[model samples]
Target chain A: AQSVTQLDSHVSVSEGTPVLLRCNYSSSYSPSLFWYVQHPNKGLQLLLKYTSAATLVKGINGFEAEFKKSETSFHLTKPSAHMSDAAEYFCVVSESGKLVFGAGTILRVKS
Target chain B: EPEVTQTPSHQVTQMGQEVILRCVPISNHLYFYWYRQILGQKVEFLVSFYNNEISEKSEIFDDQFSVERPDGSNFTLKIRSTKLEDSAMYFCASSFGQETQYFGPGTRLLVL
Candidate 1:
């Protein structure tokens, strides 16, 4: 079994400020972790993924996430937030070819 | 970049009516999937398809739900009878294998 938990239901950040969204996972096998962002009325866009590759993965739109095995965590981060960054973020894990998505974290960026 | 495409961006239906959602997965991709998210809920997997047959399905994929790759390029999900609880955003996705899956914009189904 594999599952992901997003720590925050909602997070607010001012434009140009740093952003962080936390996530943790539980998996029986080596996990494939992913971060996806969904803008309003839009489909999910893949942010980044960890498939036993680089521990620190970089994604589109200046976002990145670090996969920590000891902590059982894969937290998404951005050096600075933009108004366009407002969206819902999901942390997902793969199990037996099925994706298990976490309760999403909504990111609200204010100017 | 190749992407998954779905039809009927929004559909409203009456209870007990049948609704079919359609999708076209990325070309050359071998795996296809359907997922749904109720308002404010996590995205839940409904089913996965490969080789013209269902490879995996979730508990939510009951007898009322069926998937078909009727043609070489298109996949469809048919609900035998729509329920109020069935109102949700349904998404279609495709992947090369067990790798990252690309999602479609989704069909917002509203059952009254």
Candidate 2:
């Protein structure tokens, strides 16, 4: 069985400042990880994904995440936060081709 | 940029009434799915479909819930009877095999 844990339920970041949302996973096999963003009342948008290919994955809207195997973490990051970046973030893992999502992290960007 | 599309962006229903949510996945996509989010909760997988049959389903997809690809370009989820707890945002998603899944905006069902 595979599961994901988002370290924080909420995070606040100042506009133009750096943003970091932490996530860790537990899986029996080498897992596939993904990040999704959902704006208010909208569906989830795939941010990025880490297959067995790249350790550092780059996503849309200038976001990226590093797949750290030893630490069991796949934290999302962005160098500069924008008001449009304010939304809920979800860390997900895939096992047996099934996607299981974590309790999302709400990100608030303030100017 | 083709994506999954869902119907009835918002639906209000009474307890014990049946509600059906609809979806149209991207053309050529072979896999379809339904997921739900109770306000402030993690997205829960309800069911996955392929080849005109259910590929996988979670515990939450009880007897009250059923999925059908009754026609081309249409996939539907039918709730046999509604409960107050059933009020939530239901999302329809599709994917090409094991790759990333594209999601629909969701139908906000409010059971009153």
Candidate 3:
């Protein structure tokens, strides 16, 4: 069984400030992790994924995440937050072709 | 870039009525999926389809739910009977294989 947990239910940041969304996972084997974003009234958009390829994964909109195996963490980060970055973020794990999702973190970017 | 598309962005129905949600996946994609999110809940997988048959399904996809690939471009999820608990945002997704999936805008179903 594979599961993912998003540490924060909500995160607030001012424009140009750094952003971080924390996530941790529990899996018996090597896992495939992903970050997805959903703006209001929109569908989920894939941000990035880690499939044992690179420890550091870069995503669209100047966002990135690092997959730390020992810590069982895959935290998403952005150097500077923009007002457009306000949305909900989900940490997901793929197990046997099914995607198990986290509870999601609501990001609020203040301008 | 190609993307998945869904129909009936919103719907309202009475309990025990049947509802069908439709999707058109990206061209050349082979795998399709259905998922739902209740109010203030995480997205939950319902079923996965491939080659005109079901590849996998979750417990939530019980006898009331059925999936069909009626044509090369369309996938449909039918609920035999609806309940208030079934009200949620239903999403359709497709992928080239078992890799990353692209999602549709989703249909908001409200069962009253």
Candidate 4:
């Protein structure tokens, strides 16, 4: 079974500071990883995906994630946090055509 | 860019009533999916559709739930009897294959 665990249920950061949302996965074989963001009352938006290509994957809204095979981690990062970055983030792993999602990390950007 | 779309941004219904949630996938996409998230819960996959039939479904998808692509563009999920537990945000998504899926603004269903 492919599954993902989001380390933090909530993360708070000051504006213009770097942000990190941790995630770890367990998979039997090579896995596909993704990060998605959901603003309040909005849909889940794909931030980035890793499919055995480059380990470092860049996504929209100045977000990126690195797939670390040894660590079994794909952590999302942003150089600077903006107020609009406050949202719920989900770390997902794809397996057998379905997505196994993490509990989610709620990001809070403080001004 | 072409994106998936869903109807009835919000719906309130009485328990035991039937409800149909609709979706229009990207024009050229071949695979479609439905997922739901209860309040403060992880998003869960319900079912996946391809070639006018269900290709995969999760354990959460029961006989009470059915999916149809009645027309060339529209895909729908029907719940035969709505329950209070059914209240959640339902999302519709589509993909060119199975790699990446684009989601639509979900429909918030409130069962009273």
Candidate 5:
């Protein structure tokens, strides 16, 4: 079984500042993790995924996340936050073809 | 780029009435999934399908819910008798093999 936990339900960051969203996972087997963003009234868009291949994954819009097995964390980061980045982000875990998603983290970019 | 598409962006149905939601997955995708999100709640997985059969289903997918791929491109979810609690935004997603899943905009079901 695979489960993902998001550290925060809401994260507020100022424009031009850095952004971080924390996530952790518990899985019996090696897991595939992903981050997705959903804008208001829109479907989810994949941010990035960490398969067995790479620990550090880069996604679109200058966003990236690093998977740390020792810490059991996959935290999303962006060097400079933009107002358009405000959305609901989800951390997901998958093992053996089953995908489970965390509740979600709502990001607010304060100008 | 190709993406998943769903029909009837919004539907209003009375309690005990039946409803069918439709979706057209990506062209090259080989798997299909259905999910639902009640207002102010997290998205919940309902069922997954592959090889023209159900691969897995969550507890939320009860006997009242059924899925069918009647033709080459369309996948449908049928709710036998909707209740007021059935009001939600239903999403249809697709993927290839075990890869990333792409989702549709979702169909908002309002059962009165």
Candidate 6:
């Protein structure tokens, strides 16, 4: 069985500050990890993906996530937060053609 | 950059009525998928389609649910009997390969 756990249910950050959303996964084999963002009433948008090639993956909107095999973690981060960055983030893991998503973390950017 | 598209941004229906959610995948994509998210919940996979046939489906996909790619471009998910529990945001996604999938705007279904 493959699973993903997003640590924080909600994260608040002021504008121009750093942001972090934590995630951990359990997989028997190498898994494909992805970060997706969903704005209110909008579909999910892929931010970035990590196969086996790169441990550090860069995504859109100044977002990035690091895949740490030792800790089984893939945490999303941004150097600075913007109001537009407020959204629900999901950590997903894919194995054997199926995807398992985390509970999701709601990011709130305060101006 | 072609993207997937879905229709009926929102739908309100009575229980027991049938509803069909439509999606148009990116041209030249071979794989298609459907997922749903209940309010404040994780996104759950329903089914995956390839070669005009169902390649895989999750436990959430029951006999009451059926998927079809009736035309060359349109893919549809049909719910035989709508239930109150069926109210959620349904997303349609397509991928050229088995890698990253592009999603549509999604259709919000409200079964009353």
Q: Estimate each model's TM-score.
A: 0.99, 0.98, 0.99, 0.99, 0.97, 0.98
Each candidate: RMSD to true structure? 0.6, 0.8, 0.6, 0.7, 1.0, 0.8
**Tens-digit lDDT track for model 5 on A1-111?**
678999999999999999999999997767899999999988888899999788899999999999999989999999999999999999998755656889999999999
Task: Write the candidate numbers in order of decreasing lDDT.
Answer: 3, 1, 4, 6, 2, 5
Q: lDDT of candidate 3 vs native?
A: 0.96
> Candidate 4 vs candidate 6: which has greater DockQ?
4
The global C-alpha lDDT for each of the candidates, from Candidate 1 onward, is: 0.96, 0.93, 0.96, 0.95, 0.92, 0.94
Per-residue lDDT for B6-96 in model 3, tens only? 9999999999999999999999999999999999999999999988899999999999999999888999999999999999999999998
Higher-lDDT candidate of 1 and 6: 1
lDDT of 3 by residue, A27-109 (tens): 99999999999999999999999999999999999999999999999999999999999999999999988899999999999
lDDT of 6 at A59: 95
Over 4 Å off, model 1: none
- Across residues A46-67, which tens digit of lDDT does each residue of candidate 4 receive? 9999999999999999999999
Best by DockQ: 1
Model 6 chain B poorest 10 in a row by lDDT? B37-46
For model 1, residues A9-100, the per-residue Cα lDDT tens digits are: 99999999999999999987679999999999999899999999899999999999999999999999999999999999999998888899
- Residues B12-93 of candidate 2: C-alpha lDDT, one tens digit per residue: 9999999999999988899999999998788988999999999899999999999999888999999999999999999999
Query: Candidate 3: TM-score?
Result: 0.99
Model 5, position B12, has a per-residue lDDT of 99
What's the i-RMS of each model?
A: 0.6, 1.0, 0.6, 0.7, 1.4, 1.0
Expressed as tens digits, the lDDT of each residue in B1-56 for candidate 5 is 99899999999999999999999999889999999989888888899999999999
Candidate 1, residue A95: the lDDT equals 88
Per-residue CA lDDT of model 1 for B1-112, tens digit only, reads 8889999999999999999999999999999999999998999999999999999999999999999999889999999999999999999999998889999999999999
Model 4, residue B61: C-alpha shift (Å): 0.9
Chain A fold similarity by TM-score, each prediction: 0.98, 0.98, 0.99, 0.99, 0.97, 0.98
List where candidate 6 sits over 4 angstroms from the true fold.
none
